[model samples]
Target: MLRTNIFTAWIYRLQHTDLSSKHTAVIAELRILLIDENRQRAESLTSALNNSRYKISHLASPNISLLKQVDEIQPDIIVIDIESPSRDILESVSTLSNYNPKPVVMFSADQNTDTINQYIESGVSAYVVGDIQSERVKPILDAAVARFKAFQKLKVELSDTKQQLVSRNLIDQAKRLLMKKKNLSEDNAFKAMRKTAMDTGQKLEDVAKTLISLLNTI
Candidate 1:
């Protein structure tokens, strides 16, 4: 019974602990760009975040140069509150995703499935459909940042995989060319390419590309 009570107390402390406070300096330095069409709700949100130590810049709409604003401000995160997102807003968000690529958190009253999917496709890290309460803001933003980092890591891994596949194909093509033209065995051709790569202090992929370029011309 005593062990159970101690375990329960430890779990409660863990659940109630504010882990974000450990990174208070980092959190305090984050810049948040807020976009909301409704002034009243924007004010409410700003008030709720007043003590959160985040630097915020509010914009009424993305009708202006949204790209320029993002570039100039260079915010760490973007928070959008709207009833229903317009086509222009999605376009702007898409542009940001392509060029700027900041973590985006969207709060909307629109419960349509298509609209929610559109927002996600436009690079919104977190899409909340309901009222925006004061206590939910920080947690939502933290989740958005986490999701964005995870997505970026996945993208990099995919890109690396694609490059590796291309390089492997190039190396195979070069090896086959050597086997055919130089009358070398398959293993010997690969060894010759590897030796040239090491001697020239260049990548095997680069040497493969050079071999292909020269052998194709001959």
Candidate 2:
């Protein structure tokens, strides 16, 4: 019975796989900047993408600076199809990562470990080591979008956590200063800061910073 149940589940998945994977009907509602040296390949990929979902723009030349193009186009996502990425291409992507962050999908033939690592570090969200075909475009794009969103969420959380830590350290420093300057207990110093924050409609950290500055000047 267990074997039969397993077989039935496998059949169910096989039957529904195509239906579940198809994304043509769903609207992605994003602007995609496609960078492809080969015009023929670019057209093929554009045709494959859901017209209702993606607003597509193409850059047929390879030598143009990608950062400038991206700044002008301001696309939500970028897709690059290249045989092997050059140093200029990697540098452009790295600059884009620092300045204008967007999800990047690269379809490249080069599978060298160092090259792939460079691409990742340069902020390529999805890297495919094969031909850029129409049939595979949607799935690859979906994966790229998902990965990009997850990564962005983690980055935001990390930033918030770091800021909280810094604020906490500053508050602690201010509290220590207040305790020493006024000969107040730690609890009293914290209460005084909190009261000032509430009265002035300022944040506790802001009040702490002000207190620290004032105490230091004296």
Candidate 3:
């Protein structure tokens, strides 16, 4: 979390460092998608973002084919600037998170805190309210990317931890079932499980689960 805060603060500083130029070299050669119903606003954002050497694509509105468009474009980051973030729009953003899972920047003219939290939970890396500026684009994009990566790493770690717990539980359950059914000692039961796993070329957890399932059927 500290890393996220420091990275965000650094980006903010980068945005204000040079008032004359939109310093964007940090995010050069990156692909960006701009989703806005308002064509003028989209164009303005595109022009602003383009100055920083980022590739920009525009989506006029959220459609059923939004995911397909995303797959085709393969944007590194997604930028959404809408007057009001509608349900359909939010769903589209959620779908992006579920499917491609990129850093998303959502710029809303105004919104309540509840709706903002919903957006953040649903996958908006940076939820900005009020006017969107050209100078802040590069920094926000970089910060969003950093935050997304950190969150993704945490998610992967959590998933691995959960799987490990499940595996441990399965092994313990298998051992008890062995003791109850075969009258085997705990050490012998574990040895038998390890031996079976080695013989079948399967993981110990998988072998344990399979043995437990087989015994339950008998």
Candidate 4:
């Protein structure tokens, strides 16, 4: 009886763990902004995308107000159903692209080659034309999100590399000063610098900078 009870408890725990893992694997709810002059079309598009993983909000207004709505909603994706590529629409999206975490997709019913080229050049992540379908929307959204995340990671790495280079340069300069002032070898100077850093609870780079500043003043 004791063995049976232990097995049952283990099985229950295993099932619960599996369920939690599955839930976590599902992407977080995405916020979508639908901009279209045709109220009916916007409503239909919103309904189509209302799945478990997406929380869509929509706006059916003139092009001028659409920009304001986008600022307020701060959507993960913006699906613009353009019948014609109006100058105002293009300008608004162009301005919005300057923002961090820009919108993912822009769609239109009219598929003019020149317009498509312009949209791509303007930093729009993905473009689609004609009646949008579920099959088309999902893949584009996935790619856009992936691309934005990659850009963010690259930016962070670049910033970190720059800081490290600056720190190394400062340390090198400090070591040279110590060798000149104390007649110590490079390794010994570094050791003394490290000891100073440990004693003062200051970073090695900071200590190096301070040493350089003092040397400069003299």
Where does candidate 2 have its weakest 10-residue lDDT segment? 1-10
How many pairs of residues in model 3 come into backbone collision?
Answer: 0
TM-score of candidate 4 to 2 decimals: 0.66
| Clash total of candidate 2 | 0
lDDT tens readout by residue for model 4, 12-83: 434554454465565787787766677776766666666746667776654556667667777776666655
Ordered by lDDT, highest first, the candidates read 1, 3, 2, 4
| lDDT comparing candidate 2 with the true structure | 0.70
What alpha-carbon RMSD in Å does predicted model 4 have with respect to the real structure?
13.0
RMSD of 2: 7.7
Better of 2 and 4 by lDDT: 2
If scored against the real structure, what TM-score would every candidate get? Answer: 0.74, 0.73, 0.72, 0.66
Sort by TM-score, best first: what order? 1, 2, 3, 4
Instruction: Mark the regions of model 3 whose C-alpha exceeds 4 Å error after superposition.
Output: 1-28, 51-53, 61-65, 84-98, 111-123
Candidate 1: regions farther than 4 A off: 1-28, 82-98, 111-123
Judged by whole-model lDDT over C-alpha atoms, candidate 1 comes out at 0.71
Q: Show the colliding residue pairs in model 1.
A: none
Model 1 earns a TM-score of 0.74
Q: Which of candidates 3 and 4 reaches a greater TM-score?
A: 3
Reference-based lDDT, residue 193, model 4? 93
